[model samples]
Target: MNILVSDFDGTLTEHDFFELVRRRWPLPPEQDPWNQYWAGEITHFEALARIFAGIRSRPGELEAMAEATGLDPNVGKAVQNLKDGGWEVVIASAGCGWYIERLLKNAGVAVKVHTNPGSIGSQGELLMTLPYKDKFFSDTTGVNKLAVVQDAMERAERVAFVGDGRPDLEPALLVPPQLRFAHGWLAQELEARGESFQPFQHWSEIAEILTRC
Candidate 1:
């Protein structure tokens, strides 16, 4: 079966989904740890965990923020079409799976999603449970984006990788020349090195290209 791998936050969604959370769900007065984490004082995992723990302290805020962000209208239809075409769609994102899963659930799009695990404390504080410096750089915010793609490629006959941010460049490069790369960034540094990359402003363009292929 054909396989389609995509990044979750910016690529599949309209914008950076987490930023919405940060904006809508500011930490309570006691939670200065999250602010320090964002300032680069602590590892991303630590910061993210603190953020989650802080948010969980509130009731129903996380779900509300998720509903506000919604999904990429264009990609939603495209993903459904891909599934109808017998393609196994998987999301390999650097962001936390906790939020992405809810977003996908809201979008009414069902697919295999691979991402870092997030936890909530007894007090409803959000914490990132994945340890950094492990096999996948557990402490990082954008963790192992490439490694997830490589794992997908290993299991599939042919794979198409799609992503938006600079973090995704590493994983997109791993696909064989024949595979497709649906990129959201207009110009990435990888172009200077003669890498095979394709720019896509919308998933509709990707749908067109995939249909031809």
Candidate 2:
């Protein structure tokens, strides 16, 4: 079996949910919990929860922002193509599953997802929480990406790992250079480490290449 594990926010979509949130909220560096996250003062899950709890969305605004997060239109086709060629695709996200699930369902695709659980409050607060306790639970990311990828390696004859964020670095490194696909931050970090990987702008492009192989 061939397994393809992907990150949700920036890897599967054009924009990270934080990008959309920051655009609207625009917190000052001193006040933002993200600043502490970058400084190694807090965990990734806490940073996300802190940021989301502060966003006061009004009714449809959050959903609209999610729509604007720009899930690639080709996602369904990409998943279909990969599945046809014997790839079992899964999403591993450090971000909220609320919008991730929303986007996938909206795109008319069904892919198993491992991510942080989240919901909206009656007053429109974006409430997010760490995932249920598991062996793969992470102190930083709500989901342990490295563990997820490692498990895929254990189950499959071949595994492909793809991602585009800070949390993706270690897992991306775990895969063979040829089977790793990266973009943005992950790409830059891999290049700095003198690692080799296929860079991609869209998941469809990745699907195309993987199916051909």
| TM-score of every model versus the real structure | 0.72, 0.97
Model 2 scores a TM of: 0.97
User: lDDT of all the models against the reference?
Assistant: 0.65, 0.91
Please identify model 1 stretches exceeding 4 Å from their true place: 24-44, 54-58, 74-76, 119-125, 131-143, 176-187, 192-194
- Per lDDT, the best of the predicted structures is 2
| RMSD of each candidate relative to the true structure | 4.5, 1.0
- Tens digit per residue, CA lDDT, model 2, 31-69: 788888999999888888989988888889999999988
Once model 1 is optimally superposed onto the true structure by TM-score, how far is the C-alpha of residue 61 displaced, in angstroms?
2.4
User: Between which residue pairs do clashes occur in model 2?
Assistant: none
* Ten-residue stretch with the least lDDT total in model 1: 131-140
